[model samples]
Target: MTTVRPLSCPHCGGKEFSFPDKGRCRCLACRSEFLLDETPKPSPARPSGGAGPRRLAALCFLLLLLAGLLYALAPAPAPQPASQPARQRAATPAVTYELQQLALAADPTRDGAPLVLRVRGGLGQKGPAGYVADCYDPRTQAWSEETQRLQDAVGKNAREIRFQAMSDGSLFLVLDKSRLFSFDFAARQWVDARPLLERQPRLAGGVVQIEIGYANEGDALRVMTADGTRRYFYPAVDLAPTYDELRRMVADYRHPQAERRHGFTFARKGAGTSGPQQLIRYAFLDNKTGPRLFGGYLEWDGEGQARHVKRHAHIFRQAHLEATDFFTPDRVYYRASVAWADKEDLIISFRPTPHPDAPSLLQSLDPEDGAIRWTLQCNFDGELVKTADGFYLLQGAKLFRISEGRRPLAEPQRLF
Candidate 1:
């Protein structure tokens, strides 16, 4: 009945529609029915031109400003520490050693150079099976292997082996009680000592023990038999002496008569002569207790003139001197081993019998005054060796060079 504005479907916003009823219309594009009044109408034009674009720009600037404020207020992620390279660790050194039985051989040909004998084999093995002898020179700090094999001559069931250096630059290897082998340095081989052993009359009896000592002439070997007889044989000569005969000979030549003085009896234990000076070590026993009371030494001139007798009363109380040696009657004995370090000092090694837990000690004493110069804690059973180079202590598989200075006992240098 009047001019009608254009109408579109509300569901699909399409201008194309069909009137299904007077008030309802159906969209041809979406095929949805809707009331004619529910259709959307076009928007009217605004008076403010381009205001929406400026408002959108202002909203974007506000969002950026808010984000900047949040970044400033929040703690800036803690500056990550600059990455660094890792540090490396250091390296350690290596130490090497071997467990074995070692013995010292003093070679006169090498000017008292220490020759160590190292026995390599199983402890339970009979005789010399898998046995080898390795030599160590302490002066040079070097090791040398022996080329000769010792299995055949050294014998089975050998418990101990020892080397005795002779005056003629030769060596004697004593293999327990089984056999003896002489080492010829020139030929570099082991020579069976049977021929020399046959030269002694006492060889008919089984040899029980052997000892080496310095006689007036040269190096002498003392052989003991199971029948409680001892015979001294000179390796350089065919002459041998019986125990009693040798005792008489030694008493007449080297030893002085036992003397009683100051309520003690003094018997010579050792003696040495150097040119015009002579020194004699004596074991002084108490007249009543019969135990050794102290250490005594006699100093005299070559003209048979006697010097003052020096008595070391403190020596009896030292740990090296057994308490039994001082207290027990008729049990007077010296467990300490003594060696002459030089013309002036005597080196003594001993362990205290009373304090069995105490360490063994090496003490140097002035023979003239009996004053202790210094003391070193070491193995009492270690062999105290005197060479032209200096004094050495051979204990087990280790060798220590002893210092002769007056300074307090410093750690000894281990040569091996």
Candidate 2:
């Protein structure tokens, strides 16, 4: 193929044109400057630095996005082991125990006051330097007016070790020890309060008593905080269930049986082989409820299948509960710290405050259905005493025997 060149300048229509440079031309007759052809000239290339930052910025954004996605998809952390340093953890805010009246099932057989069981929480600035509790003597079956602080209840060392009441008339106390003298009224002499297990407590006698000393579930597994409120993972009850039982339960609930291949277990809930609220808690490590610890109560229907399952899932990253309310209600009860439950009365923590005089809210429920029979405002100062015949709620030094019978709580018999 042959290439042909035009011999005219478009600028001035002159045939005589001269090249001023490789890219440009000029007409000699008209003195007009022009390019060799009508093709547009290319502009100078921009510096690489000009666009480098924008590309770099885009790359950075992609890396950041990837990092965020990885973080979101990560598995939830497991329950922290006891050995991990908690330097990064925020302090657990102190919870004020507003228990002005503590139910003392000191002696149900005798009943004036229940049994005299006195418990005191550490008064962090408001009153006391320690936590202490006492029970009526089993020998005399009487509430001792004087309560001596157990060695375990001193300073802040054992402040968080809570006292729990059992369905049995017997009280359960746990501690390494601040010792107590057991007087045998039948023998009229002081006896050794021994043969006591350091952690596992049982209602051995009519009155709640134990040898004084905090028997650490394991070697002082934790450093005692100044306020004695630091929590540690105690030895768990060896209740890991068998795989066959769990499969049966999961099948009963009508969910995918293959789902049981993952981690799961079930445990019975009740006290000393008694109560209408008996249940089996089916716990599984599921992220469906946001991981952490999620499970439910396996309530069986008349057809022997799990019809209603009550769930228990919460972020317990800070502290472990040594004890919880005895009764689990159908709905949420905000900060429901259950104190005690008997044949007639059920005590729930009212609110947190500094005053010792503020009583906890006590509700009497029908033993048959757990419906609220009545509600009474009572203190948990550990002054509610049980005698051979009735119960009494003590505020300060004054004794107000709890009005008995089926009257509404507002009409609680004003027994002196």
Candidate 3:
């Protein structure tokens, strides 16, 4: 008998087998036939208990790494309060304003008296309704309001009203160029001048142009007919000339010479001889390079010759020589609009061309050499009023007192 050994199939690892021949055996589970080998196989070794310590150390390292990741992902803690007190925000600086608004419209007369008018409604639609007048004495800085309401007597049909102050301390109101009223501090009431105006034959039958001037002995209201015939009314004496004066008492005031030169039009002109030097100021406009304003002046000799002509021209965009003209679509022709010279200096006001919405500029220039004395930025265009001590700028519903000093402008003082 041969010695027998336990056998298993190598391909299928089946343990149960059947003997097919003397040297071959067939696996019962896999149905494979193979030669049986009596050789013994070695077994794999099992893990020992010492490996547990290594696994536990690896798990602790993993937990530590996870905690570190979580710590890194978390948000930073709130900042701790400082040992010293916290800093405070800085305070804002105070702003300085330049212009002030008034309740009434103020203008100056030839005799240096300011005429203040208060109109309640629109001048074009409601006329001079609810109107009051005041006479301001610059010498005393006192205001005397008129006693009567002008609208009560004039009525609302007088759509337009113009106030003119005479050299003799009287005020004239021309309503629609058809009706005339005169008042003085003594009269205290408006006197109807239509009767005096009707007395003149030349003004009786036709449409005439009425204007106030210092043509007669004192201030007179002159009425010119369509045919160039003129009549004068002296409110001081209530006198209207009987016959048209062949030779006028005063020659017409001469305007500055305006001539286009060097691609510029002298659109505005002003003449002032009150200063030590006589200057014919002009505002030049050049439409070619956008719109630029050039403030210029011509020094004239007694013989009507130009002694020196100087122009200060610079490039600007959409510069307006006359600020009011920006709103007028028809382009009205004007003789003087921008510049005038007082006893001390040549004053000019114009809209800054570089910035369309910027405030208009008011500048004083030296009468001798045309050097800039000082400059101011005003919101609205104003009329300059010359007085004994200083100048007053009459803007719409606002008054600015300008002193002779080199400083810009002083605080506004309410007149009434």
Candidate 4:
């Protein structure tokens, strides 16, 4: 903060002081002035006189004569030896590794062992004790029982149980329409109830399914229902999108006649409810300018609200064709032929397929815009697994890597 201030002269008691660009300031009183510091500058060269020019000409002739005498006395340099041909070495090709369906956990505990995938079968009449915790190990290449039913037998209403590894080396299990349950592997005990799934509204027909969406901020599991409703399940926070907007998306885009189920995406910015949250309907492509809307299909903002903002068209334009079944996270380095798009601003991959009657080939669309990015000859299931180099695509048991820049590798390698 350099500031300018007026200075008063001591002699004449004048208030004026000069601040010059090239020199120091001077006081107007008593005509007192201080000399400014000067920098040293190189002096300009002067023209040479006639005597110097003649001497320089004589030196040049003497130098030429000395060079001729030296050349005449010295033998011509021997011809340089013929250069030998450099040996050509063959290029080593990139080593490709076959991607096996290896089990992966959330945390690193065991050394390259299959993850403990626990699944609850049909509930028996044995009460809570009947619930079984079956462990899937890659060493034995089979499911082993780590612990049997400690409590009463589980009820027969038990369907598929969702299992995910926690950061604390614990397994999270949530039965459909049930509360969240955490199983600690180290302590070998069922701790407090980890609420990861949201409760469903009671209807004439019971809620058929509740699939976990992409992971959002705070590591909350975004839950999707058979209907169009979506709920965010973190530790203690709960957020549901607008009911009317979800219903409209289901009726218009996902499940038109109530026969099919619509998809929903939740992208969170930070942890807990304080963070920015966006709930988007997985349907249509459209842009917005304040109240004015544009593009092919209209969609709600990421927060699942009706805020009229520009739908990201740049990503859409890059996506030539879109697929509903894709991997989470847009950038994948697996040896697979699968890629993801921005599902509600979240990363997910998809592959496009051609129509039965139309001759137009299917192309991968950019998430920024609806424009196509890559053309695919065959249909892809979009099952991508992460590997060391890139993501692994498990298509018909053949593993392939989806290279950088959205290009599919050659043939797939057999994992089995």
Cα displacement (Å) at residue 213, model 3:
9.9
What's the TM-score of each model vs. the native? 0.47, 0.30, 0.40, 0.32
Across 75-96, the per-residue lDDT of candidate 1 in tens digits comes to: 7677887765454233433322
lDDT of 4 by residue, 57-142 (tens): 99999999999999999978989977655553455444322111222332234432223334444343223223444454333455
Error of 1 at 372 (Å): 3.9
Model 2 lDDT on a 0 to 1 scale: 0.39
Candidate 1, residue 104: the lDDT equals 64
Whichever of 3 and 4 has more lDDT, that candidate is 3
- Each candidate: what lDDT? 0.55, 0.39, 0.48, 0.39
State in Å the error of residue 218, model 4.
7.1
- Decide which is better by TM-score, 3 or 4: 3
| Model 3: ten consecutive residues of lowest lDDT | 323-332
True lDDT of residue 384, candidate 4: 45
Among all windows of ten consecutive residues in candidate 2, which has the lowest summed lDDT? 215-224
User: lDDT (0-100) at residue 294 of candidate 3?
Assistant: 32
Model 1, global lDDT = 0.55
Of models 1 and 2, which has the larger TM-score?
Answer: 1
In model 2, how large is the Cα lDDT of residue 397? 32
